[model samples]
Target: MQKTHCIIPFEKNRNFTGRESELTQLEEMLFAGDQTTKVAVFGLGGVGKTSLVIELVHRIRKNHENCSVLWIPAINLESLHQAYLDVARQFGIRGWEEDSADVKRLVQEFLSRESAGQWLVVFDNADDINMWVGTPTEQGTKRLIDYFPRSKLGCIVFTTRDRKTAVTLAQKNVVEVREMSEDVATIMLQNCLIDPDLVNNKTDTSSLLKELIYLPLAIVQASAYINANRIPFSDYLSLLADQEEDVIDLLSEEFEDDGRYQNVKNPVATTWLISFEQIRQRDPLAAEYLSFMACIDSKDIPRSLLPRGQSRKKEMEAIGTLDAYSFVTRRLANDALDLHRLVHLSTRNWLNLRNEWDDRANTALHRVEDMFPRPKHENRALWMSYQIHAQCVLTSTKDREKESKEWYSLASRIGECCLSTGKYQESESWIRQTLKLKEEVLGKTHPETLVTMNNLALVLDRQGKYAEAETINRQGLHWL
Candidate 1:
């Protein structure tokens, strides 16, 4: 038997925890069929795709004595070219020392040969589709996909943040890396902490993991922070839950990891920013949708709440793009979309960094205002479904936005909805806000102002404040 030669760039992560099922499934797939195998492991940016793949590589090296391995960081065109050049040099491919030699082609040809033996090539961070498959107009350009070696004894693996890229490369043979289970996450958190006693308080440790959304990179980063600052898990959770900005700030803090690319930002908040920029450059509508989503609630987003694109098809396509990136997922019960909570916070920070928050917030406000239904009995189901999102938009509104007519109009509708549903106190609060805005913009005697005043009176009556309600009623009558 020929000896296996491995060229894995990173050492196996000693703190790697969980992922038993994924590792098993990958091993099964690699050895399943007689033909060459291709697999793509895809997920959200911080979900630990690379770490999972690294673990898989080490396992394969341990178990399969004849299986050689190579690792390529296919992050971009330049990196891909450089990795191929290194491969060519390592393989001692003919004429590789010459600048004129097609090093990528040389590496491809060498790997395709049966003399290369059973091998696996891992394309880590292969998120960009344009690099693998060139644009339609770039027919003359050589694509990275064209250079993939073909051999029955070889396998290919890709780790990416985009499912579309995964599908393009591996078809049905794809594994989606989702957030870790609580048990798995807890174990990983314990392994990562310098002081294992920090995890002794299981509740605080669990809360911290949940706040980080059970993402592996986030868990690692949080552990690093806690270790460095000598803070308890409870304190970290407090910072995370204090406010959106605090959460963003925590995720934005850079940390060092030996397993990660040195040049890449380690923070979860900024890591996905690369994918956001790519989406913006490739599909503007998808980017617009992301920005709009960031300004509202992260969960249970109704389809109608989003602004229409050129057509329904275009809108679905835009949504599809976001879905492909694992930033948003369709809920099983009602098909309503839910953005990942952490992605939600990070995207808002991204917009704030670019000074685009106000515009996007206004856009979200207008869309919800336009789609919010009246609180009629027949529209109860529809309005109820929209109620939470409407509240989210209102909560996201700034002080200046509170003065806008659009803001009050939505508030009035929500207030009426609350009234119809017997939420007397909540209804009173919304009505009060709406009435103040109306009174300021349209004066006390304006018909709209009177309508708002009447709504307030009705809410007060519901709450058993009959005297105050009657006083307002009499004042409205006097105005009339």
Candidate 2:
């Protein structure tokens, strides 16, 4: 029996979250005695697909001594070919010794044989479908996916975010990875903590887990923040509960993950930005819609809000382009859309880095405000859905008053509706939050901040807090 030939770049992530079922399912597919099994695990970036594959390989290595495991990356041809060279060096391929022939093909030919034994080869992050298959659209010389060694004695697994790529590479044998379960996510958060006792408060730990929406990468990142800053989960949650900048700053802060490449400094943003750039290059229209979606609430995004072309056909095609990569998901109930919150944040950060956030943010703010009616009795259904999306944009805008007047107006209207609906406390909370932000951004003397202060005092008076209301009024008058 030969030892495994697996030579992955990084050590296994000790903090791996729950993917037991996924690992079992994938393992079964690999060992099903199909030497040419082309199985794929596909999902959004940082969704733990790679971790699942790595765990499967680990199990196979430990339990099956006769099996040979080869892990290669398909991030690009250069990386793939370098991996091939490593394989050649590892296996002592004949022609590769003197570098007499093309080592890549030699390595492929060497592995694509019965004598290769039962092997499980993993192509992690096989993102570019055409890059593998060498389609006409691909720049320079195209290479068919057959470049990888294929043998009846070997099995192949691909991890990709592109659903179409998964289909192309694996046919019907594909598993769609999803976010971690709440319990598993909590466990991961606990594991990543430098001091487990720091999370002694189960309630706070559980609350932070839910706030992260049970995503493994985010859970890990939050834990990294906690460990590095020596802060509690509750404090980090407060930042997340605050402005978008807080969330952005928290996520944009980089930490090491064994499963990630070394150059990938920021896990959440850098990982997704790769796909975003690809989509932008492939179809600018899809890119535009993605940026637009990033600006709104990830849930219940209406088709009417998208950038539609001359015909509905064009609109569906644009949406399909995004769907192909799983960047956004469609909600059948309301015929709306939703996306991963991290994806939403990463997209905005992408724009902010490129200096395009203001353009896209302002566009979405104006459209949501003008298209959706104020929250009122006539059409509460439409207004409710529309207002949710509008609020998403409003909250992301910083204190730059001139750049966000439309958003401010919309927020004011929504605040009024909250008061009329006997949501006095809710209205007061909203007014106070905005007033604080405006004061920070526009200063107390700024006209908008004064108006916000007046509204906050009114809401306080309405709530029968006359003394507090008087103090707020006096502050506004003094600022004047």
Candidate 3:
């Protein structure tokens, strides 16, 4: 038998993803002084916090033979009490079951003993501070943190979505588990796909991983879908882009994880919906801001674009709420904020399920359209930040027909900016795209459509593609 008879059940497959740095950090914390023994791994739901902690569990059992380990589910007070009782039984503490003595208090004192050797206890999925610490009510007497056994002989690891609770529980020892690195994501994807592909397909595999946003849960889910349907990755990618509904459809399809995750079921979207609902309930503004962000691009969103001015302090604090939970990362250099791509899609889908997708999306588009600068040479620097965001938002939308018309102007402005900056190919592509949209949305002979056609021909001519340019100019002449 191993040293930890009461450890969390390790998955038989034993194929864990990245976080070598995190695992090492955890190992160091286990042996460090009192200031570091107890560590909290906190991040957005489905960001692999639990999986990383589970890996830590397996490592502990292997490296520290004298260490005692326990897994506790702190979903609520009752589960916590039950976990404490179970551990008490494992340690064989005297009279732990008796109503005469408090089981929690006794379990606490026993595990705090120096004889306990190097002990580690993991409290998984502690998503709520109120549940652990108990909000101000009659039951708020003792928090779960208060009952934890603290000793140099023992260490406690917590996995939570609540940063405040994490700070209160683990103090300075916190591991903010972010998304898996691209290389790690690629490895996970290669491992996840059941079907064999040609050796030359690695580039496509990397592309698909990027499309899945490098989130481990999303990557795993996509791979499972591919394997289950026996479909090629290319097909899944095509389906994924069919519409937001398709992405939602894929995300909501349930799969069995073979009991690896305790209560987190397979649907990647559902796992995040729980967090979405919680965020909505706790802070509606933050939730709205998230919804708005989903409408924008997922990267390098400047604080300048969000609601601002004299209320800047209040707005920043609201955004900070998201930063605290690892939903968005605030870049220190330019104060730009980036959202996880899957999280962005999931947020839109979360709203979609409620039939709020179009209204919300339209609102987001209008926000961007309102904020976007008109095509002018002086504002070129300002357009740089908004360029990618506009393209991302425009591309993510499935229904180009229902999109706000202002997007055309935005496109033209960005295209003109691209032209002036010597990005000829990009400029040509955007001009051609908007010209086509203008022909479709406004009839072929509409003055605006002719103007767009002329603009496209000009850019095409500028690119020295005379044949295409002459062809566009001829079509315009025929329409006029």
Best by TM-score: 1
Provide the overall lDDT of each model, using Cα atoms, as 2-decimal numbers: 0.88, 0.78, 0.76
lDDT of 1 by residue, 338-392 (tens): 9988889889888999989888898899999988877889878889988998988
Q: lDDT by residue for model 2 over 167-235, one digit each (tens)? A: 989999999998777777767877888888866788988888777767777777777878888998778
TM-scores of all candidate predictions against the true structure: 0.95, 0.79, 0.76
Which 10 successive residues of model 2 have the least lDDT summed? 135-144
Ranking by TM-score: 1, 2, 3
lDDT of 3 at 103: 78
Write candidate 3's Cα lDDT for 11-100 as tens digits: 634557678999898888786776227889998777788888878887787887778878988767677778878888877889987876
Model 1 pairs in collision: none
User: Any residue pairs clashing in model 2, and if so which?
Assistant: 134-143
Sort by lDDT, best first: what order? 1, 2, 3
